[model samples]
Each structure stands twice: as C-alpha cells, then as structure tokens.
Target chain A: MELTRRDAAAALAALGAGGAVGYAAHEWGSGGDDSPDAPDDGLATDEEVRDALVAVAEVVYPSAVSGIAAFVESFLAGRLEREDHGRGVRETVGELDELASEWYDGPVAELDPEDRDRLLREVGADVADENPEGTTAERVRYYVVNELLLALYASPRGGELVGIENPQGHPGGTDTYQRGTP
Target chain B: MSGPATNRARNRAVDRTPVDGADVCVIGAGPAGGLVAARLADAGYDVVVLDAGPRFDPGDRQERMERAIRPAYDRPDVWGVGGERDAHAATGEWFYPLNHARVKGVGGSTLHWQGMVMRLHEADFNSRSERGVGVDWPIDYADLRPYYAEAERELGVAGADDNPFGPPREEPYPMPAFPPSYSDSLFAAACEELGISMHSVGNARNSETYDGRSECVGYGTCQPVCPSGAKYDATVHVERAEQAGATVIDRAPVQYLEHSADAVRAAEYATPDGETHRQEAEAFVVACGGVETPRLLLLSESEEYPGGLANASGLVGKFFMDHLFAGTGGVLDEPTRQNHVGFITSESHQFYDEADAEVGPFKLEFFNYAGPSPVELALTGDDWGDALLERLNAEYGDHVAVGALVEQLPREDSYVALDPERTDHLDSPVPDVHWNVGDRALETIERANQVQEQILDELGAEVTWQAGPDSTGPAYHHMGTTRMGNDPEESVVDPQCRTHDLDNCWIAGSSVFPTGGAMNPTLTIAALALRVAEDIERSL
Candidate 1:
C-alpha cells in the first residue's frame, strides 16, 4: 500500500525525531572522525543522503513492501529539514560511502540490492548492538536501520501490514476498540 | 473584604495587598478543591480557589496526547511536571516516584489518571471493628453513601449495579457501564472456572455523552492524556465553579497559612509575576492531596501553634498510606486482543472484604492494555520483511494479564514530613515521603498473585511474568496523611473534616482518610470534598 508524506511526517513526529536528532548530533560530535578523507564540510549533499537511505531501506524493509523509494524519500524530506538530523544523516551516509568505496570500489547507492545488503552485514550493523554512540555499526543501526523501521511502522499504511488500524497516537474511535477483528 | 495581616512571611516581606478575600478560600484546584469551590459558589457563598500549576487549554490536549504516545517525550513532561517546582524528597525502601505519579495543574492529577472510580467497601471504614487491624474511620459507609451517589453523578460516572461485593448504593450511576473489552470476554471462561466473579469497573470516562462532555472515543492514551474531553477531569468542576461566580486563580501556590490560636487568618500565596498576595476568608479549605496537604500545614508553623497550623496533636503529617499493586500476566493459546482498551472494564472485588483472612483486602483487576502494543512489538523486533510480519502476527495478540490493588495499613512510621535540607522553588521545605511496606502488605500481595496465577492456569496459559511480593509497588493512591478522627490528639481533622484545633479552617481530600481501602481514592476524595463543602457552608 502507498503511504503519503503526511503519514511519514506523523510517524517521525511520534518517534520524537527531534530527540533522536539531538542524540545523533551528540553521538557524531563526540565520536566522529575529523580526517581529511571525509567530505570537506563534514556533510554530504541532501541528494547523496537520500539516495543512500533509499538504498538501505531496500535492504532493511520487507521485500513485499512496495513504494519504498517514495516512502523513504518522503520520510527523509522531514528528517533532513532539521539541521542536526540533516548533518547526522549526511555524515552517516558519507561513512557508508567511504566503506563501500574501500570494499566494492563504488558508492553504496550504486551497489546491487544483494551487494548493498552484504555491505551492511559486513560492516557488522546486522549484528551490532543498536546504540547511538557505541560504534560505527551501532550508529548505522540507530540512525539508518531503526529510523527507517520506526517511520514505516508508525505510519497508518505500515501499521495496516500488522493489523494495527489505529496506532496509539491516532484517534481510533470507541467502536474500533469494542469488537474483535472482522 | 480585607482582614488583618500579620508578620508571617518566613524569608521575604509579606505583600499586604489583598488578593480578593471571600467567604471561602479553597486551596489546590483538584477533584476535592474543585467540588468544594463549585458547591460553595452554587450555594451563593463567595469563593476563591488557588492552584499551584498552570491552567492548560483544553485545545492543547491533542498535542499532549501525542506527547504521551511518543516514546521520547518524558511522561512527567507530558503534564509539565518536574524541575524545582515539583521537586520532592523520598526516603523509602521503595522509591516514591512523586513527580511521575502527580500533576499540579488546574485539573491536578486527574488530568493523567486512569479514571477508575470505586467506593471503599463498608468494612473499609470499620477495619478495626471488623478485621481487628487499622483504625476505624470516625464516619462509616452509611455517612458517605449519599455523597458517593452525588459524586458519581457530579463526575458523570459510567457504571452498572453489578458488584455484589460493593457497598449499598441508593441510586444508579449517571451513565451505563462500558461493555467489557474483547480481552475481558476471553478471560470470562477462565475466571468462571476459578469461581472468580468479574464485574464492571466504575469509571469517570463517559460511555455515552453525559454532562455536556463527549463520549469516550478511545484515543487509548488515557493515562497521560485523553485528547477527547470524554474522560472527567477536575477542570470540569473548576469551570463549573467559575461559571457559578467563583474566582479561580492558577499558578498561585500558597506558601503558608497565617493562623491565630483558634482560626486561620489568611493564606499567603505567590503569583507568577513575582509577587506575594494574602487571601483572607471566613473559612479556609486545604485540598492539596495527601502529600502537599500535610506539607502545607507543616509549612504553616506559627509561634502560637509551634508544631504547625492546627497541628496541636503533632499528627498533621503522620499515618501516610498508599495501596500497593500486584500484577501477573501470560500468553494464552488463543487471541486475547490486548492493548485495544486503555481503561479496565472487568474487576473482581470478591476478595476485597475477607474479614477472616490474615492478609489485608485487595481488589482484582483485569488489564485491557496488558500486553505490548503493535508499535512496541514492531519497534523491538529484530526481524524484517515477511519474517517481521510473521513475528508481529504471532506476538501481538494472545496475551492477558490481571492486576490487584492490595490494601496497605497506615503506619506511624510511614509519614509525610518537611525535608529540612531540600526546598522547592517556593523556598519552603519539600515533602519528604517516608514510606515502608510492612509484612501484612507483602503477604496480601503474595495471596493476590496466587489468585491471579490460578486464573491464568485455568486458561492453560504460559506465565510470562509475575510481580512477586518483593516486586510490588504503590498504585499512586496517596491517602491517610491528615487522618480524621473524633480525638484531637490522634488526628488532624474531625469527622466533619474541620481541624480539631481551628473552628473555621477545614481540610478536604484523601489526606483526611483514616484508612484507605484498596480502591481508587478519587471517588472518596470527591465524596469527602462535597461533604466538607456542606460543613463549611453550615459553619459560614
């Protein structure tokens, strides 16, 4: 099912995007490398970040899930507007691209779906304990994998996939709660 | 309307500028204060009510509900609780999370409460006479029965006359009870097998539109915020009081009460714009819940009454009480449809009046929001795609739980006192709650859990979790601080809720409860507040 930008924005707001963004900024500020090999501004362009997130969403979300690219793109628009979250996303994408360049001789956004999935596994993001400030793997899981999942599930369309017609924040009336599933 | 103002300011110069003296000045705009102010105002008595917190706009409830639903928004921050303003000290075996459990705004804690309204059983008032433990209240069930009906109607309670264990009522509830949730239906057979009878819980949330409020449209975030004005909050009565021509001031925390040998002269309060104002009245009512009511009295220490204002017995803050919770939950083989209902529908009070048992009384609750919500299950899972969908379907439903509120006896050791070292933003000693769970309470919790396990076993469910006796915590129903009694030396207030030491000054709320039965205290708080209003009116 198709999800709109409004659904994605509501999802982001429910997940406390501002708090997550602040945590991301704090994590990146304290632990991020200041190497010359990094981007000149220590941030990637919005297009680059969007491309990388959509690529990662392809691997993280269910294969049955449709319109992932549009959903992730819509989700990113709201997320990237926040300066702190934008910089955190940009830096995270830059790090992923650096690793892709070293391992696959290409950027993550250009890799095949299977290769992109393998890249996340190889970076230990699939196995790492999800933390905002622990390690590269943990940061990837916190900012990339979890962020996408939270956005998806918090949305009404995504919630429908699991039979949650009305998530907690949404105003599902009394009749909705009174009976069993039809 | 100005009265004599004395030199009662502790740290700063007292502002003699009178902030509208009335016939009755009610402190704390909670359920108790709201009811008193409304009744007095309607009776043609001039009333002024002062609240320590902001008057939240009802329009902001949607955003507040969102804040409650979101994981990152701190729960206390949802009601604007925390900081130095709400700071309190806890010296108990179990950490009394006061800030998390209370709201100080115009609506008070009812703004975030679960809206369960149950009257104390007949035996609750005669615990010493019937059960051989705890002190008997000066007034019994018969005394408050009419007021309970009035309170139920006033708060627009939705309930049925189904509880055989409940005290006798002369009238039906204002509205019919909400039908049991789907999960409650699932537990019916198991409960039947165990011979544990379940009945509808009386709730302030509207089943149908009553008293101009909307019917509960199940926003599901009832604890911290109800976006719809379906659930009854004290703001309802506060507004009613205002409509009846009572002056209600918010963000005006009373610092101290200046009292003479026989009566309270005035209440010195601090306003938002950095000014102190004294309010004098023919009668004064302190309805600031259990903790703050005693703290305020203790803060009102005078040279005439060295212990505190109307604290001749030195029992102003003693005998503090709170009901402890016992919870048990498991996964049933069939779908239970958990997390659909935010408030409870089914409860068993059969064990609430066990006179022969050594353990204290307890009321069993069937939890509707027992299991994890869809968002919680989705966010925590490690799987993705069809695997994630499989996990969600497998784990989302098929969960059920039962909780019980066990009675805690009022002990002299468990008290609310002024924390000498820590002061609040008002530059007065914050309330120090010294609470300790006794052996009887622990025994009661164990017994309650056993009964819960029996029902779960009858369902052939795998027990996922159980709150053992040691794991028990309070249900946040603060009571019995300024206990009411016939003797002035033992209790702070008399049977009429008037201070034994002062003729005109009165105390309202659960602070005057001699013994808190294992029920939600708000209903009784309302009943007592209504009664206190009558007492104040008669005296005036």
Candidate 2:
C-alpha cells in the first residue's frame, strides 16, 4: 500500500446521526505545525478531519458498531481540551483527509465502504514502508485512528476484547486478574 | 514537657505570643522529621515540629492524585516554593530535575515515596576505609543497627529477613512480606535460572493492620498517593508526634535560626500569609530533606556566622549527592502483570560489594513494569484499530524496567547553594544546585547497566529501552548535602548529626549522610533521625 500524500466519509453520516460534537473542518494539518514553536493546539476541531477519522475508524475497528463517527469526534474534542500536541494532531487528521480525497476523488468521509477500506489499506502499507519503526505513523495517525483505539480499548466496553478485567488506572480489586487468556 | 495539644498542620493557627513550652524544635515533618519529632515527644520533650507544606489527610489521596498528575497543577506546593496556581520552575537546566519526583507536605516527601525501605549495608558506613573514596560515616553500622530495627518496627516494614544480600538484622520485619506481584514470580524464576538470588524488598506497606490503619485495598497508585493507609506515609507519625504532645504546624517554613556565640536559641519561621513567628527551644533539629535542609542553613547568614549558621567549617552545604539513577531492561513475550502489588516490589544488593572505592556500588529495584503508557502505546506500537488492540494486548504489559540506584561519591563541586538573585515568596533565596555525575560513577553505571541486561536476558526477554550514562537522572534519594564526619573542617555534622559549629543545633536526615550506598535512603534517614533524637534527648 505505498499510498504517503494519500489517505475519510460513512464518518459524516454517523456524525449527522449522532451529533456528538461541533467542529470547523481543516484546522490542524493546514497549520503545518510540526515544530517546537507549534501551538499545543493540535487537537483543534476540524469537521473534515473528524469525518475522515470516523471513516478510517470504521475500516480499522470493523464491526456493526455504528457510532464510529461520534466516537472519533468525541475523542478528538477531548484531545483538543487536554493535550498540548492536540492542534498538530488535528492538522495530521486534515492531512489524512487530503490524502484520501486526492486518492478517491471524493471526501473520505463521503466515500463508499469498499473504497474507504481500499484507501486505508493503501495508506497502511505506505505508513508501514515509511515508518518501519512506527513512530512517524503514530504521529500521522494520532487523531485518525491510533489514539482512538487507545481511548476505546481502555474503556470498560472496549476492554472486553482484551483479557483486561479493568481499564488501566481504574481502582479495582487485585484478585480479579484476567480469568482467561486472550 | 506537656501543654495544649495543637495541630496547626491542617489550619490551626499558632498563638502570636511565641509559644514557649516547646523544648525542641524540629523542621520538616517528613520521614526524617516525623520519626525524630515523635521520638523526642515520646521521650517527653514538648517538641514543636514545623512543616512548610500543608497537612494532607490520607482521605484525600484520590483528589490529590487527580490534581498531582495534571499538567496544570502537580502535587500541592509542599516545597514552600509556591502554590498550585504558580507554575513550577523549569528545572531541566539543572544537573538533575526533581520534576515532581519529590513532594512537600506534612508527611514531606514520603507523601510521594514508594516505600522501598532498607538499611545501608555495613560496608556502606566505612566506604572510605574499604574503598578509599568518599569520607567514612563517623558512626558505623553497629551504631545504627538497633535504631534500624526499631525504625522498621515503628514504621511497619514488611519482608522476610532472609535476603542473602541484605545486611544482618536483629529481627524479622514487623509484618510478613507482601505477596509477590505476578511480575515478581516471573522475575524470581528467571533469576533462579540464571543463578542470581532476588529478595522481596522490605516495604513500609502493611500486610495486615498493626497500627490503626487498614490493609491494602490494592488500588495500585502507591507512588504519590495510596488511597488506603496500607502503605506507610510520614503523616502518620506527624499525628503521632501530636499525640505524644508535640505541636505540629503546617505551612511554616523556617526562615532562619537565631544563634548566640555557639548555640542556636530559637527558630524563626514564616507563615504563608507573610506573618512571622519564633519558637524558642533548648535545641533545634533540621530534618528538612537534603534540599531544603541546606537551603535553610545557607539562608540563615549572620554577622557572626558569615557562611551560614552551621558553616564554621565552611562545609554546611557541600558534598551533595543523589543516587546514580538509570534504567536497563527488556520486553518479554507475556505480560508480567506487575502493577497490582506495588512499585519497587523487589531489589537485590548482590552488586553492593562488587567495586572498591574507585567505583560506586548499587542495588537493582527489579520488577516487570506496568508497561508502556498510553502515549508510548500509540507512538511505538504497530497497526491500528482491531490490530492495534490485538498488538497492545499481546505486548503492552510484557516489559520490565530494572532501574539501578547506584551509590554516588560525594564531591564538593556538586552542592546546594542559595541563588544570589532568585528568591521565593518569603524573599528567601531559592536553592541553586550544581550536580555532576562523577566520573567514578560512570564506571559503576556501566556495570549496573550490564547487570540489568543480564537479568533481562536471563528472563528470556528482548532488550528494548536502554538508558545511557547521560540519560541517568534523579532517584529522589537526596543525601550528603551536610556531610557528617569527625573532623569539623571536613564535615558539617558530628557522629550525632549535630552541627559542629553550634552546640544546640543538629540535623536529622540523609542530609548528614557522608557516603550514601545504593539503598532507597528512607529507612536510613529514619534511623538517623531516631539516633539524633536520642542524642538531643540526652542533651535536654
């Protein structure tokens, strides 16, 4: 999948259905803020980036779980609220959308399901080739999918996928060590 | 030696009419101050202990952890430096950064301590005699042995007495050792296979209630806060000091000591509100940790004592030292599932005698880490979505961080001095420190790193995170700022930790440590404080 300047829409329909959070599209990647002086506003809201992420999450966390758009939007909004590197993250999300739009000839958030999957696989292959060690992709996918997975997997609902008895940092009894192997 | 029992540690105000009955004044109610103050008051001395930080109730452990971990406000400003709203100084420029590694409060730094309590080895006391580097401690391990035992009992240390590498002890730990964490069992099996012996570290956490405190509820946030009093914090002794008739005052940072020709007459302290109060005492014990103790002495400059109150030998704030801290370890195939028991569950002193004076000795606080934090998960981890979750599930907790806390030789160049220009809220000089990882320590760190790798390899783990010599930072084991020795010219305190320059002043903490071995420093600090209180009681 050598797809780099390449890489999001089922995300918007879901957002329109969920109305999880508000946003202005294209705030992050547009700032070109991968510098020390970059504002810690990497999580600034971007409708287009949010839409792209939901589409990516759909491909990433495939299931009949219909709220990918709302989850991604809520997670990005929280990042903008808490972390300094957030605005840069929002920027990367915008970049991801640009790549997807360029490749598919349509907004990623507005793409057909099969096209969205194909675009994600191509981006994944390119990210793997470019960042064999994985750090660059982590940054590239910070707002798009990776961080969303962390927030999701660390939740009681999502933690069920792993053998995790309790979400990390939560106060739970020790005797409840995971009963079965994943 | 008795009067109205007051606990200004929370919000109780001191009467303006300089409270007169206090026979001894102890500053900084941390592990050092708490033990000494309690001992003195128990001996019926009418002690008055002053802590610059606010008195934190153990009940607020959850709230404090929430506030402490945030980017905006860390733990409450127990350092007497500033409040939560005030931004902390960027200390990255310093030789070593404390960066929330130390805390200030009624319990002092113990509020943030992980409680890996252990006594310095017998060989640690006479390092100069054994290896010929730093000055030897004026007193030997024999002198502190009884105090160490008593301290373990008083603080409720839990562990077996069978660590082959541990120094001979008079008694077993006050409580049976905490059940080994899952990581401990795996690491122990690994060490056994490699012909290396591992010991459960003597922890100040409780197994069952010996004191009025409850057993461990196992919330797993033991570093800065323990929701259950299962883990020991110095605040327990602050209340005990009050019960023993000592007046415990909080937010009272001692500004200076009033002294006559060769004796300290009273301690002058400032309230957070800018009000000043003086407590007259027969003698004064400075138990402020390594940093603030020297800061206090250096700030107390007078015409007679030009260098500082305890600087007749010009050695009040020299020979500062901290553990030579660095991490060396690897990632394993299966999760160790460690965080359940506690941080620093086990350590070994097998390498304590490996080097003579030319290189520092060290101990390994060994355990499987809880694994890469949420941030690390995203950065270095592969895949996304379901694959991401699958990868994290497989690799997240499968890691260990064998951090070595190596002994440091005291050098005069690395010291704590008052900044000439910078001042705190009370206009007292802010402490400016210069720390250099000694060239000798580099040799020790290299060997320690090698040992760390050996452990990881023995555990059949693949090496991942390796910290080089330059990456070593503070371990919070502050010591030797006010070096203790027999010679007045070469040391600040005598064998009893009293200032050689002054008759009625003394110190109680690792600040008086002449040569710090690779122990955690809390047990030894508490032992020394108890010893100092004994001496002060005799003088009284």
- lDDT: which candidate is best? 1
What is the C-alpha lDDT profile of model 1 across A1-182, one tens digit per residue? Answer: 66666666666554434333422232222212343455476465667777888898888777767777777876776666455555667777778888998999988899998899899888877766555556877777766776687678666667677666556655556665557764
DockQ of 2: 0.10
True contacts kept of each: 0.46, 0.19
Indicate the docking level reached by candidate 1. Answer: acceptable
Off by over 4 Å in 1: A1-61, A68-156, B1-18, B380-391
How many collisions per candidate?
Answer: 1, 18
Per-residue lDDT tens digits of candidate 1, residues B1-540? 011232123113423245465899999999999999999999999999898887786755755665564443578978889999888999977678888889998999999999999899999999999999899999999999999999999999999999989998888899999998887887888899878899999999999999999998766788988878889999999999999999887778999998889998899999766889899999999999999999999999989888888898999889888999999999977767666558889999989888433799999999988777776555444565567777877777788899999988888989999998998897889999999767888999999999999999988889999987878888888898899999999989999999999998999999999988899999999999999999988888
DockQ scores of the candidates? 0.28, 0.10
Error of 1 at B368 (Å): 0.9
User: Among these predicted structures, which one has the highest TM-score?
Assistant: 1
Chain B vs. true chain B: TM-score for each candidate? 0.95, 0.91
